[model samples]
Target chain A: MGQPLPAPDATDPRRAPDWVRLLEARATAHGARLAYRFLSSRGEVVDTLSFEALAARARAIASVLTAGGAAPGAPVLVVLPSGLDFIAAFFGCLYAGLIAVPVPPPRPHRPDHRMRKVAEDSGARVALTEARLVEQVQAVLPPGADVWTVDALPDAPEAAPRTPGPGAVAFLQYTSGSTSDPKGVAVTHGQLLANQAMLAEAFATGDPTSDGLTSKFRVVGWLPLHHDMGLIGNVLHPLYQGGECTLMAPETFLMRPLRWLEAIDRYRATTSGAPNFAYELCVERIPEAKRAGLDLSSWKVAFNGAEPVRAATLARFAAAFEPHGLPPRAMTPCYGLAEATLLVCAAEAVEVDPAGRVCCGRPPAGATVVVVDPETRRPRPDGEEGELWVHGPAVASGYHRAPDASAHTFGARLSDPDDARVFLRTGDLGYLDRGRVFVTGRLKDLMILGGQNYYPQDVEALTTQAHPGLTSGGAAAFAVDDPAGERAVVVAELHRRNTEDAAAARDAVISAVLEGLGLSLSEVVLIRQGTLPRTTSGKVRRSACREALLRGDLARLDGMTS
Target chain B: MTTPDGTPPEAHRRSSRASSAELRAIVKSRAQVEKFLRLGLAEALGISPDAVDPTRTFTTFGLDSIKAFALTGDLAEWLDRDLPATLFWDHPNIEALTGYVADVLGLAE
Candidate 1:
C-alpha cells in the first residue's frame, strides 16, 4: 500500500514529518477527547473542543485561508486567548502550511508592548483575531496588511492540510522585548517533533504500552496559550501523547490561587506546571476555606518552572498543600524555554523532605546541561554557579529574519566534547548541586553591587518577609540606572489599604533588602496591591518593571516623609 | 466588592463607576482618539470587568478620537477602542461596559 510507507525511519517518522498531518492523524484517532477548556468572559466555562471536532474546524479554516491566495509559510498573526478556538486556529495555520505567529492576546488593560513586538517582528500580513476585537488588533497592524477575524473566513469544504517536509519553518514564538523591538524564535516542525519526543521519553509516557507510565494522564495548566510553556508543554505535549487537557486564563489563577488546585482536583489532572511564582502565590494568598477542599493526591507530575526554582518557595508550597492531600513527591521543578520548544530539562516526581525542596533533578531523557563561565564561555565543574546552557533535540532553530539575534542567543555557544551539540545559552545563572540545577537569576537580572553579585529575587524575599505591613511574596526588586546610576530599587505592594503612614513599612523593606544584600536602594515605591507588571502566566515581568521605573511611570516617593 | 485604594475620603460613598468615569473622562480629554482606541482600551480592558463591543460602543456616540483618552497616559492612547485600561477583562461586552460608563457618569435611563 503506497510502498508500505517504509518502516518508520529515524528521519521520517510515521506521524507525518509535518505538524499539520500529525495533528490530523491524532484527531482522527481520538476525536472525542477534550482538547481545551477555559473561563469565558462571564467567568464561566464556555468553550470545550474535542480533538475530532477541532480537527474538522481547523480543516475548514485552512481551506478558507488557502483559497484567499495565501502561500505556505506566510505568517498569520493570532491575538486570541487560551481556548479551543485558539487551538484550532493555531493548528489551522500549520495545516495550511502558514507560519503561525502567536502574539500576546489583547489584555485591554496592559501596555501594547507585546502586541506591537509580535507584529513588528513577524511582518505578518494577515492577523486572525476574535470577532469582537478585530479593530483592536487592526489599529496596531503593520502598514498595508489586512487583519481579519475568525468569523471572516469562508465556510469552505475541508481540504487536507499541507504537510510541509521536515526542516520547514512552522511557527514563530515571541519572547520578552520592548515595544519598539520584539524578539521572535523561529521553530521548525522537526525541532518541535524532536522536542516532543524527548519530552515523551522523559515523562515516561510516549506509548504507555511501551514507555511504562500509564497513558491516561491529563495535562492541566493555567499559563497563557500564547506562551511557549502553555503552547508546547501544556497543549502540544498532551496532544502528542494522545492525552486530554484542561486550561484557564492566567488571571483566574492569580486572582484566586486555590482555583489552580481545584482545576487539578476536578479534572484529576496527572500533570500540571507553572513558574516558581505560582507556588509562592498559592502559599501566600490562598484562603483557608479553599485549602480545606483541595485534594492534590491525584496529581502525579506537578511542574514548577519558567522562572527560577526557589528552594524556599517549593518547600512552603508542599507544606501548605500537604494538608490537602498533595503528595510531597508530586512537585517536579523543570527548566525550559521557547528556544527549546518549551522543554529542555524537567525534574522527575521524586521523594521530597518536609521542607518541600526537591532537586531540579537530571536532564530529561536525551537533554543535557552544561554550566559555563559567563566571561570565558567555557564549561565549568559541578557545584559552580555560572551560565546554564542546554543542548538537545529541543533547542529551536534560531530567531526569524534576525541572524544577529540568533547567533547572539543560540549559534555562538561553547560546545561539549561529550555531547558534541550546540547548547542554548539559558542566560540564567545557576549552579548544579550534585546533578540538580539551582537557578539563581537571569544574567541581565543579576545585580552587581559593592563587588558582590546579588539576584533581585533574593533581596525581594528578605524584603517581603521582614516587613510586617508589606505582604510576603508581593514585592519586586530590580536594578534601575539613574543619575546615581545602577542602584537597586525595591517596590513593595502593601497588604493594608493605602495609608498616610507607610514609611514604617517602606523603611523596614528597604532596611532588610539593603542589610541582607549589603547594598542601598535608590528608591522604594510602595504601591497598592497588583501593581507590578506580569506576564499572562503571572511571572513578574522584571524588564517591564524596570522600564516603568526608568520612565517615571511609577508613583513617586517625593511626598513620603520617611 | 474591592475598591481602588487611592480613592479620596470624599469619594467613599460614591460608586467606583463615577470615579472610574471621571478617570476615563480625564484620560479621554487629553489623548488622541485613535491612540486611545488602539492601546488604552486594551490596557483598561485587560483585567477590568469592563468590556467594550467595538461595533456598538464608543463608535456609536459621536465622540472624536481626541476625547478617547484625555485622562489616561500615552500607553492607553495606542489602543484602538476608547475604553479605559480597566475594561479589558471585567466588563468585556458592550452593554455591560456602557452600563458601567453610564453608572460612572451618573447618567440615568
Candidate 2:
C-alpha cells in the first residue's frame, strides 16, 4: 500500500484530490505508524500521534463540530499551542467539512487587533481553542463564535461529514500583512492538492524515483505553523506523503537555534528549512567552539525562502556546516507567497548562481511564471528583470470577499493583446535568467534615484558589510521624495553595546552607500538595534520605515543625527 | 512618547549583567517590580521608558510572544522563583504582573 503508486511529476494524479481521502487511506494502511511527534522546548519528544489515533481524534472533533451545526463552508479558527491537539483539531475541521483557519494563539505582548480583524473579516463563528484561552478568544470573537477546547468535543463523529468536492473551500489563509491590517486568501481543496503535488514534484520529495518510491524522508523544522511556509511546507507536505514531521515551537528554535540542527542530528531528519535569517542565526548565534561533535550528514533540502533568499547567507551557512557533513548543493532557494498557496517557483536541485543570487528554479509543472515590466505590462525576455507574474491551478481563488483587492491582484493579464490568462501579480521584482526566477527585491521597495532604479537590498547589503561596528540584520534602505527629488536614506542600527561608535558607524554607512551605488546618501540615520520595523513574519517593512522617516518618528540614538 | 525626565535616550540593556543583589533589589517591592517591568518592556520595544504606561498591557507595550517568553525566563531567573510561561497571558498588564510577582515572591510591601 505504501508503494509509490504513480507519476512523480506535477500531474501525479496519485496526489489525491482531497486530503480527507488521503487521511483515511493513510490510517488504514499505516495505522500503527507514527504520523507526528511534537518536541518540547528542551528538544525532547513531548507528544506522538499515529495516523490511526489522529484519525479517531479528528473524527471525534468533527462529530462535535457537525453536531453543533456549523455552516457548510464557514471558517473555523483553530488557535492553540503547537502540539497533537492542534493537529487533531485541524484535521477535525477538515473532516467536518468546515474551512480551517489556523492562527497563532494570542500572545499578550502582541496586539489583538489583527486577530479581531481576521475573525470579523472571515466571519469565523466557531473558534477551536483550549479551556484557558476561551476567555481571551471570546474577547475578540464575534458574539456568535462558540469557543470549544479540543477535549470538550464529543468523542465520536455523531454525523459523518460529506466528502468535500474538488471546488469546495479548504481553508482561509490569512496573509501576514502589516500588524494594523490583515488579509485572508481563500484556498480551495483542489488548489491545496495542486500545491502539495507541485512541492512534492519540484523537490522530489515523497515521490517514486528510479530506485522506487521510498517513504523514508522525514520533515523536521521549527517554522511556526501559522505561516504559509510552515503550514504548507513543513506540516501538510509531510502528511501528504504518509510521512511524519518532528516539530518544535518557533520560540524553541529562536531561543536556541542550535537545537534545530541538533534535533535534525538526533532524529536523523532529511528535510528542513526556514527563512534566510534562521540559517544566518545558526551561524551567528552558534559558536563553532561550542557546537562539538555535531553531525548534519543526513540533512538535505535546506530550503531558504519566505524572505529574500540571500546568496551570502547560504554560502556562510554551507561553509560553517561543511565540516559537519553538509552537502554543498543541499541548500535550495525557493520563492513563493500566500496568494500562490506557498509554492510558486523552486529550485530543482540547484546551486548558487555565480552572480551572487541563488537561482530559484523553474515553476512547478502546469504552473506558469513570467517576468513582466510593471509599467508596460509586457513580458520581459529571459535575463531581464521585472515584476513576477504567476499563473497556476494552485493560485488562490481570491482574497476572502474583497473583490476590488482580489481583482486588482488576481485578475492581472499579460500585456500581449492576443493572449488572455489571469496571473497572480506577486509584488516582488525579479528576472527570468536561464529559465529560473532570481527574485531581486520588492516592487514597493524599489528605489529610483536620478532616473535609475535601485533595489533596496543592494544598498542595505552594502551598509551592513560596510562596517563591522553596525549590527548585522539591522539596516533599512528606502528612497524618499524630498524637495529636490528622490533621495536614498539609510537607517542603520549600531551594535547595541557600542553606543560611542554611532558617529563612525554613520560614516561607514555613507561611504558604503557611496561606494556601492556611486551616490551619496541624502541621510544616514544611525539608530539603536531592532529599530527598523518588521512585518509579523520578520521581513523589514522598508515602506513603513520610510513613512516613519518622513515624519521624523524614528527612535534615534542619542548622539545619532540624520 | 517622549521621556518626562527630559533626559537623553537610554541604550540597549539586554547584553549587560547585573549583580544578584541588584537583581533582588528589582523585585523588592511592588512599585519596584512595576518599575522593572515598565523599563524592561520599554527597552525591549525600543521605545522611551516614559512611553511605557504601567497600566497598559504588554501588547500595548509592544512585546511579541517570543520576547514575552524571554521575559518570563528572565524574570524567573532574576526573582529566583518558578514562573509559568503563561504569566504574561494571565497578567495582561504590568500593574497586574507586578502585583502577582509581589504576592508570589513575598515582596508585596
Q: Per-candidate TM vs. native?
A: 0.67, 0.72
**How accurate locally is residue A314 in candidate 1, as Cα lDDT from 0 to 100?**
68
Candidate 2 lDDT over residue span A1-562, tens digit each: 0223365454332345577776776787678789899988767898998989988887888888887789778899988877779889888888889999888787654446557777878888998999888888898887876787985664543667457866888888884443324568888888988898788767667646533323577889787677788888888887787777899988777655777998888877778998876887688656675366688887867887877676677778888998887876678888888889988877865556666566888887789999999888999999888999999999999888789989988999877877888999888888887778887666777564432346677778878887787755688998775422356788877777777877667766765565344445767787778778889887888888888777777878864333
lDDT of each: 0.64, 0.74
As for candidate 2, its clashing pairs are none
Candidate of highest lDDT: 2
Expressed as tens digits, the lDDT of each residue in A336-435 for candidate 1 is 7777777776666543434433456667556778788978878889867798888876688888888887887886457544645677787877777666
Please give the distance, in angstroms, between residue A440's alpha carbon in candidate 1 and its true position after superposition.
2.6
lDDT of 2 at A514: 52
Candidate 2 DockQ category? incorrect
Clashes of each: 58, 0
Where model 2 places Cα greater than 4 Å from the true spot, the runs are A1-14, A109-111, A155-157, A207-213, A348-355, A445-562, B1-109
RMSD per model, one decimal: 13.6, 11.4
Evaluated at residue A497, the lDDT of candidate 1 is 57
lDDT of model 1 at residue B63? Answer: 23
